[model samples]
Target: MTRIVVVTGGTSGIGRAIAERFAADQAEVFVTGRHADTVELTAKELGVHGVVCDATAPGQVSSLAARLERVDVLVNAAGGLPETASGDVAPLNALLAQWHSSLAQNLLTAVLTTAAVQDRLTSGSSVISIGSIGAERRGGSYGAAKAALAAWNASLSAELAPRGVTCNVISAGYIADTNFFRGQMSDERQRTLVEETHNKRPGTVDDIAQTTCFLASPGARHITGQAIHVNGGAFTTR
Candidate 1:
């Protein structure tokens, strides 16, 4: 049977790659984004279902869940550093807004979406949430949100494990070929990131995408409630 997969924030970057991977395997893939034009364009290009949804919004998340009757896999990839959160406001208010935006984008997105679609996820299904290496380092708001994501995944895994469903977080390293940095990443910073990795090279979206596919496979049945780090030895746990 073709698996029914849904990827939030699937319009571009890592999310797009994951959606494309599943679609190529002939799964019934649905991709979501915050913009209608981008979502439609990406859907057409990748030949997957597309929905314009702001996963941070409860009403939109619930509506998206209502549209799906059954789901075999769910990838919560809708998150990024907020671009507008850094500006001229009172120092305290600015800090508060930034933190709020970061949590809403990175953590709450997955939480709300998962809660809305929990019923649609069937037995033996998989729930994969994308995390970041910054969670283990100086990520500030973004890092904290990702750290919270890992924490939430543990609880989610426990809740879903009884139903034969698996939930895990993929903590990725600095991956190339994405607008993740929104044009703010400097060449020097990129080199520094690569140098930090044992492989001496930046990671790719495919690396994360392939890992996601494997986690969703039956072979990964016993893997639940775990945060699998996909970084190139950048941040290893002892």
Candidate 2:
């Protein structure tokens, strides 16, 4: 049977890679992006359906859900670092805006999207949320939100596990390619990030994409409520 998959923020970067992986498997993939033009272009280029929707907006998320009748895999791949989270602002306002934006983008995006599509998730479906290594260190507001996401996923897994639906978080490390850094990442910083990894290399989008594909497969049915790290040994858990 052809699986119906929904990937939010699927226009570029890791989200787009996940969408492509599922599409390659012949899944009926529907990708969402905030921009109509990019969504249309990505859908066309990827041979998958596309919807222009902002996962953080209730109305848009509702509309996106209304378009789906059944979902076998719901990949909450939205979320990103905002300049306000790391840029110059009044110290007090910066603190508030930074946290608020981080939570809304990283944690709330997954929460709202999952809530909106919960009813449509199939019995053996998989719900994957993209997490970050920043959550473990130096993440600041973004990290805190991602950490919260892992906690939320734990609760989500408990609820869905009984229904044969698996919920998990993928904690990704420093990944190259895509506009994630927005070109502000200095070469020195990039080298330092790579050196921190045991493999002395940055992760590729395909790394996360492949892991997501496996988690969505039947083989991963028993693997729920876990934060699987994919940062090339940058961080280790005992």
Candidate 3:
């Protein structure tokens, strides 16, 4: 039987790459995005199903859950660096907005999406959430939310393990050729990030995508409730 896989925020970047990887394996892949045009275009280009869903919104997320009968893999990739409004006069209000957006996108999206679709996951299913190395350092609001995601994954794994579901977090480092930096990355900053890695190179979308595939595979059944670092030694477990 073809495995059913769902990837949120799958319009571009790491999410799109992961979706494409699974599609190549002929899995029944579902890629989701907030924009209709992008979702339709990506789904067509990849020959996979597309869902228009704002993963942070509970109503839309539940609607997404309703579309699936069974889920073999759920990839919570619907998050990014918070783009807070900058014109606010009040510093605290702006700060609150940034943090709230960060948590809702990075943390709650995964929580809500998983909660809504968890029952559809049967034995041997996998739940993968995209995390960040920033969670280990000066990630600011984004890092804090990712840290919370890791924490939540621990508890989620405990609850789901008995049911034969495995949950894990992929803590990625500075990956290249993605919109993640949002045009704010300088050449010097990019170079510095590359240099920090032991391999002296930037991580690629394929790098993370491949790891995602491996985790969802049968060989990874024992790997759960852990943050698997894929940063080319940039962030070591030690």
Candidate 4:
């Protein structure tokens, strides 16, 4: 049977790469995004199903869940550092807004999306949440949100492991050619990031995408509730 692979935030960046990766393997992939145009364009380009959805919205998530019978692999890739709006709000209010945006995008999106589609995830299913190396270092609210994602994955794994579903986080490091930095990364910062890695290079989308596929494979059945870092040795843990 063609596996039903669902990737949230699949319009661009790491999510798009994952969607492309699975589509190449002939999976019946369903990709979701916040906009209709990008989702439709990406779906057309990748030859996969697409849904316009805000993963943080419960109603939309429920509707997305209703479209699938079985979700063999669920990749929660719908997160990023939200852009701060130019406003004259108080400092405290602005700070709270930033934290709220980060949590909603990086953490709550995964929580809600999983809860909605979890019933369709049967034996041999896998849940892969995209995490960041910032969680290990100092990443401000974004890092805190990613850290919370890893924490949530631990509990999620325990709850679903008995049903043969595995949950894990792929904590990626400085990936090249991604919109993740939002065009704000300076040349010096990029160079420094590459230099710090043991591999002397930034990670690629394929690095994480390939890992996601592996975790969903039968061989990775025992590898649940773990944060697999893909940071070219930038950060190491045993």
Q: How much lDDT does candidate 4 score?
A: 0.96
Model 3, range 1-238, lDDT digits (tens) per residue? 9999999999999999999999999999999999999999999999999999999889999999999999999999999999777774598888889999999999999999999999999999999999999999999999999999999999999999999999999999999999998988999999989988999999999998999999999999999999999898998988
The lDDT of model 3 is 0.96
- Model 2 residue runs over 4 Å out of place are 85-90
Residue-wise C-alpha lDDT for candidate 4, range 1-238, written one tens digit per residue: 9999999999898999999999999999999999999999999999999999999899999999999999999999999996585768888888888999999999999999999999999999999999999999989999999999999999999999999999999999999999998899999999999998998998999998999999989999999999999999999996
Model 3 earns a TM-score of 0.99
Q: Where does candidate 3 stray beyond 4 Å?
A: none
Q: Name the weakest run of 10 consecutive residues (lDDT summed) in model 3.
A: 83-92
Q: List the residue pairs that clash in candidate 2.
A: none
Error of 2 at 114 (Å): 0.2
Runs in model 4 lying further than 4 Å from the true structure: none
**Cα RMSD for candidates in order:** 1.0, 1.6, 0.7, 0.7
Per-prediction tally of clashes: 0, 0, 0, 0
User: CA lDDT, every prediction?
Assistant: 0.95, 0.94, 0.96, 0.96
How high is the lDDT of residue 106 in model 2? 95
Clashing pairs in 3: none
For 193-216, candidate 2 gives per-residue lDDT tens digits of 999999998999999999999999
How far does residue 238 in candidate 3 sit from its true spot (Å)? 1.4
Cα deviation of 24, candidate 1, in Å: 0.6
